[model samples]
Target: MALVACLAVALPAHAVNQDDLLPAEKAFAAQVSRSGDKLQLTLDVAPGYYLYRDRIAISTTPADLAGKPVLPAAQEKADPYFGKQFIYHGKQSIVIPLAAGAPADFQLNVRLQGCAEAGVCYPPYTHKLKVSAAGGKTESKLDNWLGGAATAGKSPAGNSELAAKGWLTTLGTFLLAGLGMAFTACMYPLLPIVSSLIAGQGATLTRGRGFLLSLLYVQGLALTYTAVGVVAGLTGSLLTVWLQQPAVVLTASALMVVFALSMFDLFTIQLPNALQSRLAESSNQLSGGKALTVFLMGAMSALIVGPCVAPPLALALGYIGSTGDALLGGAALYAMALGLGLPLILIGTFGGHVLPRAGNWMKVVKSGFGVVMLGLAIWMATPFLPASLVMLLWAALLIGAAVFLGAFDTLSTASKPGARLGKALGLLLFLLGGAQLVGLLSGADNPRYPLKLIAASSAEGAASHPFQPISSIAELDAKLAEAKSAGKPLLLDFYADWCVACKEMESEVFPQPLVAAKMGQFVLLRADVTANSDAHQALLKRFGLFGPPGIILFGADGKEAQRVVGFTPAAAFASQLGQVAH
Candidate 1:
C-alpha cells in the first residue's frame, strides 16, 4: 500500500486523470491580512498538492509599487517540466511590504502559479484584491474562471491623499510643510497669544522657551483634530461634507471677517455689560494661580478668535492607511498644525527680538493680518460668486491696498525711503488692479489670465474637458459597467464646486492640450458631489472617498488601476497617463 501511495504521488504533474483532479480554488485556498507595513497572505494546499515558490508573484496596481514578499523556506523538489524547484506543501504564509508611502487605499494584483502532484499541472492564474489600509477584499479570478461570475465586486476605499514612507519621516515632513501653509492661510489669530507667551506680561521669554511652548500648543492642536478626523473618515462621519455646506462656509467666513475687523480696529466686540461684570466678579473670586488664569484667558481667546485656525490637513489626513493610530495620522497633520503656529512665531520675531512686545507698531501689524483674513474670506466665497464679480472684488481689494499704502499721498514726508518704497509697490498694484477691471470688462473670466482675449488663442473652450456626469451610486455603477463593456480606460473624478483643488485641476490641468489628448483615451466620468445629498453620500461611501478632488483610474478589464488624490499638475498627470491603466 505504501509503495502504491508513493507511486501515486510520484507520477508526473501532467499525468493525472482529469476526473480525479480537484478544482484550483479547492486545491489552493488563500487568505489575506495586513499588519503595519506588510500584507500577509496565507495559502492552504490540499494533500498531494504543491505550489512553485518562484512562480508566486505579488504586485500592486500602480505597477511601480515598493516592497516585495518575504517568502518562507520551501522544499526542493524535482519536476518533470521545470527541473528542480523550490515549492510549498501543506500551508504557508507570506508577507508583502505595503507601507512605503502606499496610498491610504489601493489594489493588489497577485499572480499565484501552482500545480498538483497528481496527473495535471494548472497554468499560472491571476487574482485581484481591493486593498485599503483597513483591510483587503478578495475577488478571486479562480471563481470567475471556474464559475463565470460577473466581475462586479465592490472596490475598496480611505485615506490621506497618500501615506508617508514611515512614521518619523512623515512627522518631519509635515512639520516642515507647515511653513508653506502658514503663509497661504495668512491667519494670525494666535499671534497675539503666542507673542504674549514669548514676551510675557512684563518681560521677554527666552527664544528656546517660546519655541517649546509653541510646539506644545501645536501638539495639542494636531493630536485631537487629526485623530478625530481619521476616525471620522473611517466611521463615515458627516463632518467632511457637512463642513462644506454653504451655511457652514458662510459662517466660518463670517467669523473670520469678524476677526479681521477686530484686527483692523474697526470695532471691538465685548459681552453685555451685565455679563461682563459677573465674569469679572468670578475672576476676582479665584485669587491664586494668576499665571494659570492668564494662560486660560489666552487659550479661550485663541479658540474664539481663530476657530478656523486648526489645520485643514486634518480632513486630508482622513483614514491614513488604516493605521488605527490617531497619533500617527496626527503626525501628517503636524505640517498644517505647525503652519498655524509659524505665523505666531514670525510675527513675534520679525522685529529682531525673539518675541514682540506691546508697541504702537502692533496696530499696523494687526491691520496687515486683517487684510490677509479678508482676502482669505473672499477666496472662500469665490466658488459661490460669478467670475466677473470675483474679479471686481480682487480689483477692489488691490485698489484699496494701493490707497492704504499711500499711493496718492501728497505729504512731502513721503520722500522717506520706506514711504517711497511703499508708493512704488502701491503704484504697481494700482496698475494691476486697473488691468483686472479692464479684463473683467473685456469678457475674460479667468483671473490668472485676465486678458485672455488679447492672446486670442480661444484655448478656454478647447481646454474644457467635457465629462459625463453621474450623480448617484446607481448611476455610477451603470456608467462603470458601460465603460468596462466599451473596452476603454475609465477616469472617474470626484468634484464639487467648493473644492478649490478640484477647480485647479479643471482650469489648469484638464485643459492642457497634451493632457486633453491623453484623456481622450478614457471614458471620463465625473461624480458631482456638490449636492452632498443622501445619494451623493452613498456614492462617496461606495468608493471610500472622503471628499472631492479624487481621481480613480480603471483599466479596460474594469479593475481599478490607480487612485490620484488632491491636485495633480498637468505634467505629472500626463506622465501618469503615459502608462495608461495597467
Candidate 2:
C-alpha cells in the first residue's frame, strides 16, 4: 500500500504521456508552393504540435527570393529546458517573395524544427527542394540549428496568412478590419470611455480643439501599437500577457480610481501654480490645452485596455516575429491603429458641436464621467478580485448611481420632463442593482446574468457542470484518449478567472439549454490557466494560443475539427457543435 500510494503521488508530479506525442513529421510538415510571381511556403501543423519560429529557416540557391519567406506570428512558450521560444501551429502560410529575373525552376532549401507539447522536443532538420512549374525534387537532410551547412538565412518579416497579397491590399484589409472594430467597439461600447477621458479637460472644448486632442489621443494609440508591439514581437512575448498580470492590473485600476476622484472635484489634477505657469510658458501651451496630458492618457489607456485579438493583429504579430523589420511592421500596425481610431475622429471632430453650454452643465458632465471612470476602474479590477467581491463592487456602484439619480424622490404631475426621466432611469438602475445584490446573496458570480444563478442549486449562477479540469499536457492527452475510447467527441475550453470573455461563455453560452444539449454530445474539459504556471503555459502553447478563453474541439477520431477563440454566443456555439457532433 505504501509503495502504491507513493507511486500514485509521484505519477502526477512527473507525468509524461508518450501517446500524445506525434511523429516529428506528422507533428509539423512543410512544403513550398508557387502562385505566379508569388512563391509560397505552406505549413500544415497538427493539433497539439508546433514549429519553432526561429527554427524555420529558408535560403534559396544562387540568391534569396524577392525577399525573405513570411510566416505568421508565433506564440511565446517558456520551456523548462529551452527557456523562452516562439512557435506556430495549425495551417499556416508563408509568402516567399519572388525576386525579379528569377528562373521558373530553381533550388530552394527549407529548414524546420518542432516539438510535442507533451514534454518533448525534436532536433532541427533541413529539407531541400527543386522549384519548378510542375513540381520540385525533394531531398532531406538531418540537421540542427548549430549545423551551418543546411541551415542559413533568416525568415523575412511580413504578415502571415495575408502574405504575398500585395502591400496595398494587406494594408487595405487591416484598415477594413479596423473599421469593423471601430463600429463594434470605438463607436458604441467605447464611446463612453473616450467621452470620460476628454471630459477631464474641465474647460469648454471647441470642435477644433476637440479634434486636435482626439487626434493626439489616437496618435498615442498608434505609437503604443508600434513601439510596444515591436518590442513584444521581437522578444517573442505579448504585451497583453504582461498587462494582465496581477500587479500591473491592480496598479492601472488604482490609477483610474485616482483619475475618477480628480474628475469628482474632490481634488484638482493640476501642478502647483508656479510650476504650472513655468511649464506652460516653456511649452507654449494655451491655458486649457493639455495636449501632452491627453496624449499620455491615451497612450496609457491603450496599454491598460489592450486591443482585441483579430486576424490582422495575428498577422502583424507574425510580421514582427518573422521579419525583424521594425519600420515596415510599425507602419502596417499603425495603419490598423488609425483604422481603430477612425470612428473616434468623427465623434471628436463633429460631436462636440452638440455639447451643452459651457458652465454648470459642463460640471455635471464631468461628474457623470467620474462615475463612469469609477466603473471602468472596477471593470479592470474584476478579473483579479474574488467573484463575491466583484459582485459586491458592481452592486455598490449601480445602487449608488441609482440613488444619486433620485430613484427614491417622489415625482408629481408638476415634475419637469427631465426630472421625470431622471426618476424613471433611476428606478430602472435600482431594480437592476437590487437584482444584482440579491444574485450575489444567492451565490452568483456572473454580473451580466446575476439572477440566472438563483435558479441553480449547487454552484448558483456559474457553470453547473463545470468542465472536467486538465492542468498539463499529459492530463489533456489522457482525457483525449479516454474520450476517443468511448467514441465521444471532446470540447476543451481554455479558461481563466481573469478572462471576462471566458466567464461570458460560461454563464451566457454554456448555460443555455440548447447549447448544453449540444455540449452533451462531447466530453467537456476546462483548463483553468489562472495561475499561468509553466505547466499551464505549456498546455496553452500546445495549441498555439496566446492566452485563455479559447475552445478546441476534437472529433471522435481524435483529430481537431474546430477552434473558437474569444467569446462565442450561445446560438453560434450551438450551431458549431451541431455541425461537429454529427
Clash counts for all predictions: 4, 4
- Per-residue lDDT of candidate 1, residues 1-582 (tens digit): 011111122433121234455555556666566666778776766666667778787888877564868776554443322333555666676788875777866667767656555423444555666666677535444432344442321111111212313455555655654554454323444454454544552354555555555555555555554555456434432443343457875676676677667655676654566865664455344332234444444334333333333323322442232233444555555455655556564544443354445454555655666676677666655655688887898898788889988888875853778788878888888988888898999998866678756544545543455799888877877877988898988889888764545665776677777788788888888988776666766776565554556788888878788766666678888777767653
lDDT digits (tens) for residues 404-439 of candidate 2? 788998888898887788888888988888888899
TM-score for candidate 1, please give it.
Answer: 0.40
* Model 2 spans > 4 angstroms off: 1-242, 279-356, 457-582
Model-by-model lDDT, in order? 0.58, 0.62
RMSD of 2: 16.3
Worst 10 residues of 1 by lDDT: 1-10
Off by over 4 Å in 1: 1-158, 161-237, 250-255, 272-357, 411-414, 457-582
Candidate 2, residue 230: Cα displacement in angstroms equals 12
Give lDDT: candidate 2, residue 65: 65
Q: Estimated TM-score per prediction?
A: 0.40, 0.40
